[model samples]
Target: MDNNYLIIRIDEQQNIELHYFWPSSMKIKYNYPTCITIHFDNLSSCFSLVSLCYCFNILSTSHKLYIGVEVFKAYLSVKFSQSYIQE
Candidate 1:
């Protein structure tokens, strides 16, 4: 599991946004919609923070407060691969 966490908030447009503090190496400026990945500092693995809420929803129907590490990792790999191809 990563020693990182996300901050969930709502934007002025009433959209639920998930903000992640990603390491510099993990951050990338991509043309992916619905998600924007950025660098916060030097820490953790390299992956996309896109569609995180969608990924979370797939694992929890009851809207659980947390997600499993392996599940999150797997989801990120798939998402990153898709975004990579698009970019």
Candidate 2:
């Protein structure tokens, strides 16, 4: 997937769901229940660091962390609701 975003789903117990895109060369294991690691499509050190920090900031914001996710989900729900792709 060429998605440049992360998807997080949270439940009643605060258990979180996360899905992210990873590059091919990296290996990762989901050892932590609350976190998931993504192997980026590129190994650009500067890019990766900046992106990680940026996402962390976005996810830590008071409302962006939750509201943004809900909004993205709703958008996807509506977008993929009816899909009859013509070949």
Give per-residue CA lDDT, model 1, range 19-71, as digits (tens): 44433444558523233333322113223344344433343333333523433
What is the lDDT, from 0 to 100, of the residue 24 in candidate 1? 42
RMSD of candidates 1 onward, in order: 15.2, 13.0
lDDT of 1 at 86: 11
Badly placed stretches (over 4 Å) of model 2 are 1-60, 82-87
Each model's total of backbone clashes: 0, 3
lDDT of 2 by residue, 1-87 (tens): 221344554334323334443434435463222234323222234234434654344443543445344534533433455322111
List candidate 1 segments past 4 Å from native. 23-87
TM-score for each prediction? 0.29, 0.24
